[model samples]
Target: METKIREAGTGCGCPGNNAGALSSSTKGCCSPPDDVSGKYAVSCCGPESVTARPAGNQAEKRRLDIEFMYLDLSVCTRCRGTEKNLEEAVSEVARILEAAGFEVKLHKIHVQNEEQALALGFVSSPTIRINGRDIQLDVRESLCESCGDLCGEDVDCRVWVYQGREYTVPPKGMIIDAILREVYGGPAGAVHAPSKMEALPDNLKRFFAARRNKET
Candidate 1:
């Protein structure tokens, strides 16, 4: 199965970039927001463009080359672990597909308003989509951000309590595995590709893959 892709549209009642005008979406990073729209936009990589297929036309037959969109922001230091884990996972996948000679486009969602988040039906930050489908398996903990109270026993506003420990977020490995399962059309264990066995050139690569595998 292919992932779902979300595109930013014109004049969606959100803020505009520097020119004080509404600009179209750019790959890698989203345009800056002129006003706060209850959402955060992440600017990273460099400005590139990706073609968006109409939502109604997704079933057209084509080769299954993958395009990934990592919805995040630059100032999300509070969520760095989630972003780092996502970046590391994407890098490893890029290496694999690059070796296999398949092209992939990595885009960033610059959140400027609730519309953007709602556009993709995202429940929280650090959402990973292959094509456009959310691969993260677990539902995010519900927290009342405004009240600073746990929405449930283990669900705090921004933090999560999985077992005994309360954390700002879940481990990156767990999130990555969720995306892997969504992208590969099966559970991570079912694919069993030995992602760590792939020839990686750096510590982060091994670090993230090993962590993700451990989660699986």
Candidate 2:
């Protein structure tokens, strides 16, 4: 069986070297904001780009690829809780997946700097993807004290919505639902095509810059 874990600096075959300083832009990360009464809040980031695919040959065995991307898992409560839920969800379904002839692979990615965040097409902290498809389509964010302290500036992290309710950390059932959807097609199994973007969102750029300055 083939499995691996990747850290931020290790390179994930993203296109080009660090683009250097990020430029100021009026563009927001995702689509335009809707009315406050709407079910979904305005997303903090743009549509996710398919930055990775399942590793290894599919002809050999069925494969399930899971990627957990985040910033500061150690201090960010949101990131830490999300990771824990993801792990438990995977464990609960592992045996059933194995019996059904599926091989599961999990990759934990830590976004350390601006260069890596840009390369990974990361717009928000604490993202989870299955087979390169984001579990939650809507990307909402709220102020994260932990991440803000880590970078020495105000920062916002992802907020998850499940069954019409918003949560700081994604529910375990939501993660399992996403994984099962990838494994077995259903009405909601439509795969969203990844979109292209030129630069990182200003929100993320600020976070990275603050982190770098503090470290130096």
Candidate 3:
């Protein structure tokens, strides 16, 4: 599945690097704000420009990929919470990871509807995948009021079992553990796959279809 990609457009509502007037979407370590660009401009592979450095240093770069997949970050509490917690976890370990020669790259993907979700093998929303593997295994689904508001129907979201308790949102410690494990010889790579794909949950399909229709 391919994640949403936003092209650069003319404007001064951007930050850093291309602070001045620029042609269009300036890809970087992070995406432009939704209000600023309303586009998915950032790439998952860190930033676009890099200083000329030694090849030896490049070899030491342990690229840790992070993908926070969700239906709608603006509304879904679980999705929002998970994304924030994951970002914090990565931030907490970023310095250490860099010291250990690792670079952390995170991407927040918005799954438009059910079709996109299925194509991504997304069992539910607020799905956090590190290095192409879901941190929490065993896919399950449940009704989400937040999603319902957006889709105009009862949409299901994913759940996580943390410290013996089930949570609509994943615990910060869980994300920390996931990243730490990878740093300590965990066999893994980060996410590079596109979010949009051609894939299915029956109710989800209907819900997404309804959403698409409403938007159209």
Q: Which candidate's TM-score is highest?
A: 2
Show where candidate 1 strays beyond 4 Å. 1-78, 142-172, 175-216
lDDT of 2 by residue, 91-209 (tens): 99998877755677788999887777767666677888776667776677878888888889988888887998788899999999988887777322233334444677777888988
Q: Model 1 over residues 159-215: C-alpha lDDT tens digits?
A: 433345545555655555554444455322121211112232222233234434545
Which candidate order results from sorting by lDDT in descending order?
2, 3, 1
Q: Clashing residue pairs, candidate 2?
A: none
lDDT, candidate 2, residue 194? 44
Per-prediction TM-score = 0.38, 0.68, 0.65
- Of 1 and 2, which scores higher on lDDT? 2
Error of 2 at 115 (Å): 2.0
Clashes of 1: 10
> What lDDT score belongs to each candidate, Candidate 1 first?
0.37, 0.70, 0.63
Winner by lDDT: 2
Give per-residue CA lDDT, model 3, range 1-216, as digits (tens).
112212211111111111122245664455433233333343445566233322221233556767777777778887888888888888888788877666677877787765456556665567776666677666656677787887788677777777876777788898888778766765333333444434465555766777887799
Quote the positional error of residue 21 for candidate 2 in Å. Answer: 51
Backbone steric clashes in candidate 3, count? 13
